[model samples]
Target: MDPSRSEFAIHEAAREGKAGVVDSLLNANPKLATQKDDDDRLPIHWAIANNHLDITSTLINTRNFDPDTPDGSGWTPLMIASSLKDNQGEQTVDLLLQKDVEVNAQSFNGQTALHFASSKDNLDIARKLIEHKASTRLKDKRGQLPLHRAAAVGSMPIVKLLLENKSPLNASDVDGMTALHHATSEGHGDAAVALLKAGAETDKRDMDGRLAIDTAPDAKVRKFILQSAEREGIEIVTS
Candidate 1:
């Protein structure tokens, strides 16, 4: 294959977990190791994105391999790994973290790996990120903390982890909506219960001046919020 074709081939090999092909391509053109594809993604990004652990390792070992290099959308290998599921994703994350890549690196949207982990309900990944000192209080462009993302996605385990790590239960977003508001609005009764147990204020209002219970998607969620509020010595006032 031509040298230019080898460049594209390396990316394809990385994506397909073809470590031998990647090795040959890099050997043919050493600079291909750091070359960016059309999407501005290096071979490392492709390897990690596809959960090709061996290929990822080979790419990371290359000279000048920047694990924190952002793709066209400003997504780092860490961020991409966080968005994956299962043990492969976890292993990829561990590899990146071990390289001392920026654990709190944000994407174009200002979303950190913790934000992705929380939104995806990857409890173990979230725990690892927290252990690495990923700030739970950090917000995205929308001013949403990891806890807010977890609540919006109905990730009860993630919500619990964030709260245990001192994430503010009542932390509001740009819309002035807390995790409780997201939980109730999404009709996640279990998530709402978790937020309430963590002391999320039910009376807190969003930009629309609507409380969490007011946004409850159904009677079941409303009833749960009201009952939980009562247990916290708060009254639910309905007009």
Candidate 2:
């Protein structure tokens, strides 16, 4: 068999997540296991990304696949799992983690698994990542961390978990807007309150010198801010 032809077979098996085909080919030529496709995705990336748990298991356990292989987007199996939107994704994530995959690994966005998990509002996955000491301090391209993403989406459970994990509630984005600022501007009263309760400094102004209260979308939210400020004994001088 031509070596290039064998490489093509390996690539096909990898893309289809056919562990048996991949194993057969790999066994015939062990070097084929390391071959990458055009997108630089190894067989392991496809198996995990497609939720082929059996293939993934075979690749990891029997074939000793590298868990950290990055696809075209610099997304490892763990990073891809973090972005999963269904129970199968959850299962895949859990399986990978159980195999001791690097839980806090970052993606092209500079987001740890926790950041991506929170982006999907998967409390179970979020909790699992947090429990593994997934870095809450990591910021994505937007300079927003996992906690900021959770707060923006009004994911109460994930926000709570992130707060419990000591995520920086006051961490600001490029424009100097904190999670509380985002929550307030978007009229997510509960999320705003959560951030404030988590000790997010309400008085911290944004780049435009607007506090969280000034960004409230409506009077009800404005009232909540005023009340909260009063309760916290913070002074707000407004015209």
Give the number of the best model, judged by lDDT. 1
lDDT of 1 by residue, 176-195 (tens): 89998898899998888777
Model 2 Cα lDDT, one tens digit per residue, 1-239: 65436547766666576677877786777766666777787777777667777776666664546767777887888877777775356777777777777876777867777877787787888878777778788888879989888877778888888888878888889888888888889887778777776777866888998987788889998888678767876555443
| Ten-residue region with minimum lDDT total, candidate 2 | 2-11
TM-score of each: 0.92, 0.79
Q: What value does the lDDT take at residue 112 in candidate 1? A: 96
Q: Which ten residues in a row have the lowest lDDT in candidate 1?
A: 1-10
Model 2's number of clashes is: 0
RMSD of 2: 3.8
Model 1 steric clash pairs: none
